[model samples]
Target chain A: MTRLLTLACAVFTMTLVGCSESGSGDDTLTVGFSQVGAESGWRTAETESIRSEAEARGIELKFSDAQDKQENQIKALNTFIAQGVDAIILAPKVETGWEPVLKKAKKRGIPVILVDRGVEVEDESLYVTLIASDFIHEGEQAAKWLAEKTGGKANIAELQGTPAASAAIERKQGFEQEIAKHPGMKIIKSQTGDFTRSKGKEVMEAMLKGEGGDEINAVYAHNDDMALGAIQAIEEAGKKPGEDIIIVSIDGVRGAFEAMVAGKLNCTIECNPLLGPMAFDAVEKALAGEEQPKRIVVETTIYDQSIAADVIDSRKY
Target chain B: MPEALKKLLWPLAALGVLLLFNTAMNPAFFSITISDGRLTGSLVDVLDRATPVILLALGMTLVIATAGVDLSVGAVMAMAGSLAAMLLVDMQAHLSAVIVLTLGVCALAGLWNGVLVSIVGIQPIVATLILMVAGRGIAQLMTDGQIIPIDSSPGFAFLGGGTFLGLPFTITLAVSAVVLTIVVIRFTALGLFIESVGGNETASRYAGLSVRGVRLSVYTFTGLCAGLAGLIYASDITAADANYAGLYLELDAILAVVLGGTSLMGGRFYLAGSVVGALIIQTLNTTILMTEINGASVPVEYNLVIKALVVFVVCLLQSETVKQMIMRRRAVHD
Candidate 1:
């Protein structure tokens, strides 16, 4: 029994020594990270950013890919709590059923930071902060740019993203609210593109055909992928996309930047998926018990043909 | 109508009716204007978009004829498109090389599905479902989970966007594929073999029919069709978005097959009906989009409801009760 006990003690000491040596410093912070699967390019980018940030900051990240399941995420959180992690970072796939797990984390005094998306929690103190991009503001920026570029006199076709998704709903809401301010700008046709390039192109083709592709003056897609698709549809119709119909969309993916550079897409509002650095900073602050904003809204940029040349090459995603 | 014509009649009529509705809803629906020497209009769009479904339905008709379902066609399309794009863009491969390799990969995927269903005795639905789920994720992995947009040769792009004899290449490809599938299945004993397998698997084995080869070939053909569709779709957007490329299209293919009057129970298949059914589906979708209530587009949410009603009506029209009523009415006339 003593020999086995000694063996266990030696292995535990070796693990502690190994953990102390490879991490940032002698003081290693264990952060249990439950990410909502790498289902999309954005999700993969976000996950990559977090992993790199954790490495750079010398924080131990116990990463769990939930594969877009809340139950899996909850299970990961439970495991993290069982391990008595220093802090927990949750990139929730959905926005509900998080109160119980969060409350459990709270009792253990683990500072939980919500990254990329916000979770539904009745209690105010469940999480330290939600670090996310304002999807609505991104939409508003795209619409505002379109209005300015079109001199507020344009007949638009709106290619809404996936229905009921928080981003899609917010983006659509924001665009509608902003466009409502400009009476000269009207959404002549609208359809859900399901936040994909192919659907965007198909819906845009139908939208253009319905209200006369010539009558339409602008195309507002919720993302760059859809905008790229709409551009193709417009080109197929023998109409100049950027000139005949101004194309403005959100999400500053590399493809969108390339489109803006090629004069196909007129503008793209940035929705940076690289939330890793900011998320970890918030994590560090929260763990330090320092007061942080309840919501750390990431800043975004509006890129048109003018600045696209300068920044297109620098876009990570 | 003759027996063969009767099989083709309903789906063809359904497609025609949908096109008429589209034209009525928007006069521009039927107006195919020459744009840069290519046809551009809603009708053209319907044909272009329906190409993938038509190709998918072609394979589906055979698979369903064998009383087997290949749900992986959609995902196979994603994989095939991804293989083509990634190979072409990353490896600087020739377009023909990309096409050949991609089809090869798709055929391999079908072989795996075939091996599972025929050799392992796994249920068809469950076997294809494996690829239906994992295939897209694998495609995503190949592209590093990004929409791989490639600058390809105009010749490659022509496969999707180019015109052939004043009609879109998609329509040409779909028609030729349909014709070829019909010729291959009808002229040879392949069609008979498939029907036998579907009609009675145990009896087919007892009759000395190569049941395993029939099952394998149908799946392989389905995979090849899916690969061709993936090429077209990838060429359409000039990008391979693994997640969305041919997403949920298996359901559409199956719907087209069912709409064509092919029994899901798997006998007496109609390839022409499946193609027409695909056209009807695309026409219905275009009609819905063209439909406007007082110059405002139909509420996007109600699109499904409208589709459901149309499907319900079509199903009702094909129902036994309706057929009985038609028979009674004919008797009354007599």
Candidate 2:
């Protein structure tokens, strides 16, 4: 009898809390965001964009940093659910083992939105929507730009990112798919740089020497950091990076934009990290009983030297 | 000649066999072509990439000989690289000062480890491990957790990337350092004292040898070597990656020292053997990177497996039991 009374009391209080949280006439919201650790500059930029956007929209945001651990994320999710927040945004570090916690959040009727990354699940209703950059498309854009620039007569040296990342896999696949159409275009060397500027440069140096800098026509890095590193290597080998060796890469950070404008790098395919506006829009739309797309893919632009000067100043990251 | 060859024979033969196998696998492995006034080929690539590991192995040989293991060499490399990059970025643009001061800082780090082991009487593994864990973190603090890239320092980069007399500057640097270290240690009574201390500390103490001093000197030498390597590595990449500057390289350095036929049991050492050991690892890395089955790059999953197998074969060849069996077979035939 005592246990039943406690359960009833807890549910009644939770309902009261929920009532106070969801205001009818007021344009206010409380959102809980669980972010993967800040390991890179791009991640830091994303976190800043979210905080400033939340402030602009006058939403009370509770943030949890997972520090690159799945258990921490699970704990953060449970905490958010227990607090009876209006919504939860999860930038998952991995694809699996999220269903159980998500099920608990679903039981509490708290919607979850995946940002920057996605979770694999059988049930589509677990997440309200996923707002992320299309990695495969980004790879295709890079390849397309390379093909058009080189006129299909390019011997490419690919500096891949961390070997196991989904972005690396999808990017390589998409780039190859596009490259398959061009008879003259070929990837002579593909080495893992492990997604750091130093390794990227180190690997590029080896590639430049082993493959003969004259034999190689271009470098396709999985990210701008690697491209920037490769540019240094090509220059050291006495080859003009933008002219002698066409440089193409992904991730349109401020550094890449500057490199493009400076004529050191030929092109960069954008993997838009500023998903704050879109994520908040999804949250607002979902809360208003409005139907939203299952996946909202953020559109990205390919920047080159021609318009790079104009867009470099406006680039947020 | 045969008697002398037996000391450093196994590792030398193993390196030779590995190189022959590499050449067979890739027909162009030994090919040397000049590109833009510099030697360009996989052979040159190996020498260029071998700089850091070669330096680590040189230091590791002495540490192992002194009956001490410096597991923090890799972390020391990271710390040194971070120091060099941060110093340069903060307007300390003097190349020679940056190199000298950074090496001095690493030497101090080495001195700290030496003090811990020699004075505090801690085990070498445990003593060096404190730095192994904390050193990279210190490096990260120096870099503010970023990969600091520098494009302005052309003179600084020449140490790792430039060619000297149709060969890599790193190769020349490694050879000269090895020669200098060999002369300094072998020509002086220091080498004999170090071997004696490692062979039997109690006896060496009774014989009026400064055992603590020997340990301190070896650890300090290892630190200085790691610092030099860190500079070359940073120069090669034109950046200092605090997180990954010398990740997991200590294990490889230990492996190289062992492969050079130096006894982990302490007493006696061969600097030449360690050089060959470093070359073996560098060649193995290049082989894996260059491996192509039907022009498709070997997947990342198989790279470690292939490398581990090479290590296994080299270790098995150097095993005492295998050596004993070979000797027994030769005696029976005679």
Candidate 3:
């Protein structure tokens, strides 16, 4: 048994060494990517897009699934730094716990591109560039659409994302800022659904109970998951969701469009997660020392029930 | 009175002290009101959130009573909720009432845990751990890794949203479960048998008590509790995201059990104390967030750190060395 265990350990070590040797070539560009994990459809799509883009570019992508852990992502970044990768791409799980890692990467002269999510670091030079959707803009768009649909007089309940996530914080800020402009529109009750469908449903149920049936006119979810939950709560209360309570959310996922077409979802603000092509472009520019904006804001569009059917069929992710 | 009542004094005293501290700090802490005939505000929210942890702790109490632990209750909740969601996919409109669907699915998941721990003879921690990792994967797979929003389910909504006597429906369910559990343990000989088995499995078998049966029943009970929590969770959200339902709830439940003075080594149990313990934890979390003391600098994740500290302090107090030291100090002071 002792001999067998020794042999197994030896074999595993050799397999890893052999795998690394096979991929070590001069032409291959080593790109390290720290992902948030396969937590949602958006994340999976982002992963696939990154993989496909890396393959097409002939870049050796060192991918790490952080599993929604900041420490894991930090470890992965350090590992990439030690391995001396040409560039690094990170989709942070949360905003703040990233300053030290980014500073380390900057000191090492490895270009770090922020993808999908932004970090809360004071020094702008620590990161090469941020490639992400304008999260606050997405929230603003969702609120704007809801305001127009309801004629600016509506009692709204908000289902926010995970409390610490940068996306949730910015999205809430943007929505609140826009809604505050309209005196008639008020957020009657707001809660952190933690970007989970069940929490969204639970919070919405509580909101429904608190606000009374048919008292709420709209729900502005930070993401499609919460909007879907609000729809369930509304329907369970023996009311039509889109008619009785307009549902507007971010994350233009396939489900969001389907619901829009079915008239259950009122509108969705697109926050594109497919940042592979753009991220690659930023990486190439940073490596070549070309001038690039510190923050790259990806443009987004609002989708309503009218065009939802037409676009739902062709939606890639 | 009874020895059971005597056993509860410490926990009750701890609760009283904490409540006093809270009231002193915030004058409005004890103020609870009903608006539009419904309980509104932070107190109601605390009760609503405590429901899931209360159920998990109740089941854990029994598992610990058997000298074992189940770290997979949260995963079981995800799996049961996912299974129910999968079954209701096409039959969303035609499915039975929310209570039936939720309870039935949870029962099935509970049975799965019981079989693995009892029949397979796998260690309780290892068995539940497998479900913890795989159950979330299964839940994600059920929804095709997407968040499924369920609309038009009044029966489901009522499970989470409806109120009774100005209290949320979930609190009512939790209270009833506690009562039912108390009856089973106190009124029947099963509770005594379980304690005897937990105290010494070898001796329990030698005495002709069905040790395996007791073990199975404890895990099954935990599974049911987790299932009920899942239903309440799902009903509240009105949609199921297999990834996030009951996430990290096992930790909270464990913390509650520990806070109530129940030993992880397992021997006896305290169901009511555990419920209060769960409420205490929720209140602490709510208070921390409401104060808004720069969560970014001192992130909300520090709640886990605080929980670990509380557990450490309690476990230290439980240690013979600490107890002896305290007794020595007391004797000298007297």
Query: In candidate 2 chain B, where is summed lDDT lowest over 10 consecutive residues?
Result: B289-298
**Fnat: each model in turn:** 0.69, 0.24, 0.24
Q: List the candidates ranked by lDDT, beginning with the highest.
A: 1, 2, 3
Model 3 stretches astray by more than 4 angstroms? A1-32, A54-66, A69-86, A94-110, A119-126, A211-215, B1-55, B84-138, B141-144, B148-184, B198-213, B227-239, B251-334
lDDT of 3 by residue, A74-156 (tens): 99998887777889999988888788888888886889999877778899888888888888888889888988999999988
Error of 1 at B52 (Å): 0.5
Least accurate stretch of 10 residues (summed lDDT) in model 1 chain B? B16-25
TM-score each candidate: 0.93, 0.88, 0.69
Better of 2 and 3 by DockQ: 2
**Candidate scoring better on TM-score of 2 and 3:** 2
- Model 1 residue B252 distance off true place after TM-score fit, in angstroms: 0.2
- Give the per-residue lDDT digits (tens) of candidate 2, residues B190-266: 88998898799999999999888889988999999999999888887777878888888999899888888888878
B1-334 per-residue lDDT for model 3 (tens digits): 7656655665566556556755664434455567557766656777877888999999988888888788787877776666666656556634565456666666666667778887898887898888788877877777776666554666766777787878888888988999999899978998888888788889989999988889888887888899888877766765666878888999889888877767777777777778877887776654433322321112434645765665566556546688899999999999
Candidate scoring better on DockQ of 1 and 2 = 1
DockQ of each: 0.61, 0.31, 0.18
Interface RMSD of each: 1.5, 2.6, 7.1
Candidate with best DockQ:
1
TM-score of chain B of 2: 0.96
TM-score of chain B of each: 0.96, 0.96, 0.90
Estimate, for each residue in B25-60, the C-alpha lDDT of model 1 and write its tens digit: 688787777866777778788988999999999999
